[model samples]
Target chain A: MHIPDGYLGPTTCGFFYAVMLPIWAVASKIVKKTLKAKQVPMLAIGAAFSFVIMMFNVPIIGGSTGHAVGGVLVAILLGPWAACIAITVALVIQALLFGDGGITAFGANCFNLAFILPFVGYYIYQALTYRAPAISNRRVLAAGIAGYVGINIAALFTGVEFGLQPLLHHTAAGQALYCPYGLNVSVPAMAGEHLLIFGWVEAIVTALVIKFLQKQDTNGFPPKTCGNDTVGLNAETTNGRSL
Target chain B: MSFFKDSVFSDENASKNGFLQSLDPRIKTITFLLFLVQILLTRNIFILLCLYAVSVLLACFSKIRLGFFLKRTWVFIPLFSLFIAIPAIFSIFTPGEPLTTVKIAGLTLIITRPGLSGAALFIARVVTSVSFVVLLNITTKHFELLKVLRIFKIPQIFVMTLGMCYRYIFLFIGIIENTHLAVKSRVGIKIRPKKGQRIVASNITSLWQRSYQLNEDVYQAMLSRGYNGEPLVLNNFKAGWQDWLWLLCALTIFITIR
Candidate 1:
């Protein structure tokens, strides 16, 4: 979920940015080492794919539609560290260019969607599928569950962030300076919707895409090793070239 | 799709020979960040309103249509922030001196004074911040904005990735548009929900495959052209006296407000 400006106090925004700075640094280092010279094109294409994935609205109940974040899917294909960088780049473009998210809140949004979502989703899928063949039904199921749990976790973090605002920032008279909802309201409101509707959308999209890619028997669809190898890039450069 | 294409892909407003358009994008970006910082720090509603008015005036001076800018900024407020703000005005959430009372079938609701003021302040902050951000975006070319990231010492590779991503997003969007049209033409706009999801998933896979292929091709192309891993960027940002004057004025306003 994209957090807009003014929803969180400046302190909260600053805190997230401080937290994300190291994570971003680590991610870039890992991606650079893993993908090397190929990191540029691979990450660029991944970021573009991540950006455009949000545009595909899938039909839901009652003729409504929802879009998938595709963070987990990207992680499955490109590894979590690369997914983190790709999604962060996409979020940056969204904030700076389209105004889809707030510039002030960029760090918070990336922490949730870029960091938490992909890392949690990828690991969960890894644990579930552990050593299973890539084409197995279990892998598909793992992806679905991973998507659902990943998004719900990210949403929970967002809720906690929003809920904390009232307690953290307020006037002398107890008037909220930012988001007014306490944990009781924000948690349920955010996590509940995702749990019921958006989570299922994410799950279905992830599972179906995984199934399709598996059916196509695409080589290196899900890299055997996560951060250790670059999967979808040129094979010769997979060992990574020296800068 | 048209809305996405228009709002994002079209840089007509940025290309216009307007005030913000003429300034160095790096300078404009920094000044806008200053405006956002001021907007975030202030709790005073009057100050928020003043900042908002200044954003509006900036938009006008930048040759942005007042109606278009207002609609673009306010539309997000209602969708993202208003729902939260609405409950903030009620006595249940923001307990304080009652400003007004409302009665429904069997209940009385008290809108607290503090609640109203807090809600108004939150709305003002959101609007002002969104205005400045929207203003900055609409008045600066997307590539220029990407280049401005270099000012923060973001790694050149990361910035280059971002630039390439921006360059290809439109191409993917076009592919998505064509795919949607092809799907609609065949499915006649009434595909079953499961089928619709299947189509979407397939399209996503198709796009990912295409991107993967293109990634290899582009990397090979880069290698052939002597890319050598380090991307060189043309630094053409020239901040004139007017840009410095604007920065000085912005800094002064920021300090004065503080």
Candidate 2:
């Protein structure tokens, strides 16, 4: 899901950056107002956790191993707004320090993974688990479904972004200067792999994690009520220093 | 593990007494961004080649091993760019004047000239952009790069949070490595997929619990040390005449190419 530099046209890159700027600003404001002084360490630790989550490779079929992005899981634990900041921080480190993604396409990557994935996944999980018991199996199932749907949606958006490049930035001779594949090709190629393989990986990981947390910390199982309240913030405020 | 350590934690190259290391990091970062913009805008292969060569030369000047740098940048080229470019070169993607025709099992395939040129241009853009990005990363310390974010008017707290994230990532990496080793020792390498997923989920929960605890402790420590939401940093970034000259030269080159 990490788009490298030179894959998207300058105009496309600029467009995403413009779109993400306000989203990032609002997320920052919400986190800071809610977490206060605890925001710094909480967000930093969350981002670090997000970064390391990608390193754990789970067994797949035929001896293959795949890693989960863990975006939805983080959103389930923290609020979607906080997850947005955490994932964005991790992406910045990846792009600037490790070159895993592109500097120019950083905004685009963040829009997909940080904003779209977490917000969509959290809302889906919230809607499914509305008024359910804290430690019920229904919540776990909701998490699994949310993870599946969220990542697939993000993948579809990525495919559309790639598919639009040729239509938006081709030369006069009809030769694509950036990504050559049209929507017909890029969409299926991106969405197909996630739909078949990665979506399951994300779902299982998310469900299992929720199960484990339920067993370990039953009181903290459903951290926030399904409402306008930010995820994890109410719990943190009640505990008075526990992020 | 070693790759993670080397890529994220290693700063030997950044600390070296090299040309790039002597310049202010903020200046280096801005100039690199300009170079990237130029790389994205230009369509000429010669201009792309020149930018790539400049990146290579800069890497050499920064005391980075040419072999290591080349391997780092080129490895990504095929993985990310070449596969797409290869498909674009066939007549199926970019249909135009035929350059070479291949017949396979009663099917005729044509490689068009326009297709080849488009693919070449795409590859060139990828190479040049990747080279500059790698060069900037390898030559700049990670914290300095994080600090550079402040120039964009990013909040000081956010920058500090990013710096802390960089600091703790290695700690979590160590924890992950130890956990992986323990799992390998106990279960061997051939666990069932379901078991592996369970183990990963357990580990993730454990890590989260640890991080949550650490967050409280660190916050208390900070409060004790007069950290009032705004973290302070040592501002040692002084851009001298040489830095300005380098900036001027970069801008001039970009303008000339344009």
Candidate 3:
């Protein structure tokens, strides 16, 4: 999914970066509003978690192994802004440090996985948890299904983005190259791969991580780890200040 | 690029002269993106070498260390192999000319010419892009990078969530670490649950509940602070001449090369 550099034609790749950078900017401002200072390090560690956990390469059925992005879990714990930025940072670090993704294509990868997946997954989870009669066997089942479906849809969007490349790069001479690998074969195949494999991997891991975070901080608010917030907050408390 | 960030920001490297500590986030971002584009514009072996040289030179001038760049490649090589190999390894068995033949497990292992070519293409692309991004982080602060995002016009809701998450990520890790440590101190890494799957299930359910509660608290805090949908703005780091020059260079190369 990380479009390593130079794989896509320059025009297509450049267009994506330009498109995504603004999206990233909007996400950043949202993150600034959400942060209360105390949550900073946890998010950084979350960033680190994203960088490390995605590298685990857990063994599954075939010779291939799949990793989790933990987007839903991050959203549940940190909210979408921090989750997106943290995930973006994690992805950036993964690309720079490990070359897992391409630098030129980082915005594209970030757009698909970080921006699209978590936000979509969060709302779907919320919608399911709320609309359903109860968190019964049926509701949980529905929530799981919705989350899974949401992930697949995001995957489909990514496939389409990748598929548009050859079409956009279409020149008279490049048409012959299509005979061996037409757009028909590539786009749906990539989408199908995501829907079947990547989505499932994302769904299960996300569900697990979300479930885990919910378990540990049973009080809902995470423990305080920053002194600035506490000092500033406590000072206000003592001085009888209120926003 | 990787080396530049590691030397300045890698937890341990902060002690060195913080040359990159004060650059405008927007400048760092624009340069980083352009540098990535520069790498992407080349496929010829000579151009790849030149791209690598340019990135290295930039890092040296910026005073970021060489070690930071190489340290990150450890995670990439293995992970990248998996990324490219699935599609690539599958292509080898499609009845093409065998590039190499080997015997294993009483069967012949074949690498086809097409598969070999595909792998080469995949590797080259991965290397060229990853290297440039490695440079970006080495030269830029993560927070400043986020500021750059806001300036670039990404959604405020989205950025706020990411930034708050970054701020609080450590708190959750500490809690989780303490819990893990407590479990270890008492049980010393038990292989399996004493009961059945119920223990694991219960643990998972508890975690889910906690995460929800945490977000609820976060919402309360935000509501009390007047968080109506408008995103907070840094209002710094405007794009200047360097950005235009960099973009022009990228545009020129992209059009001329292909």
| Ranking according to lDDT, highest score first | 1, 2, 3
Q: What is the DockQ of each candidate?
A: 0.72, 0.66, 0.17
Per-residue CA lDDT of candidate 3, range B1-258, in tens?
A: 234333424544322345333445566566566556555554454565566666666656666667755555335553555464444433332235666776667977776665554444445545545556665665565556555666655555445545654454445445445655665587664333222123333343454345434655776676687766454555656656655666576566555655
- Candidate 2, residue B5: the lDDT equals 91
Provide the lDDT at A228 for model 3: 22
Off by over 4 Å in 2: A218-243, B103-107
Which stretches of model 3 miss by more than 4 angstroms? A1-8, A11-67, A70-103, A114-131, A153-243, B1-11, B18-25, B57-68, B77-79, B82-118, B155-160, B189-258
Please give the ranking of all candidate structures by TM-score, highest first, separated by commas.
1, 2, 3
lDDT of 2 at A85: 88
Model 2, range B106-201, lDDT digits (tens) per residue? 988898887888888888888888888888888888789898999989865567779999988988988888988998898876778888889999
Model 2 TM = 0.95
Candidate 2 chain A — worst ten consecutive residues by lDDT sum?
Answer: A234-243
Better of 2 and 3 by lDDT: 2
Say which prediction, candidate 1 or candidate 3, comes out ahead on DockQ: 1
| Per-model TM against the reference | 0.95, 0.95, 0.61
- The candidate with the higher TM-score, 2 or 3, is 2
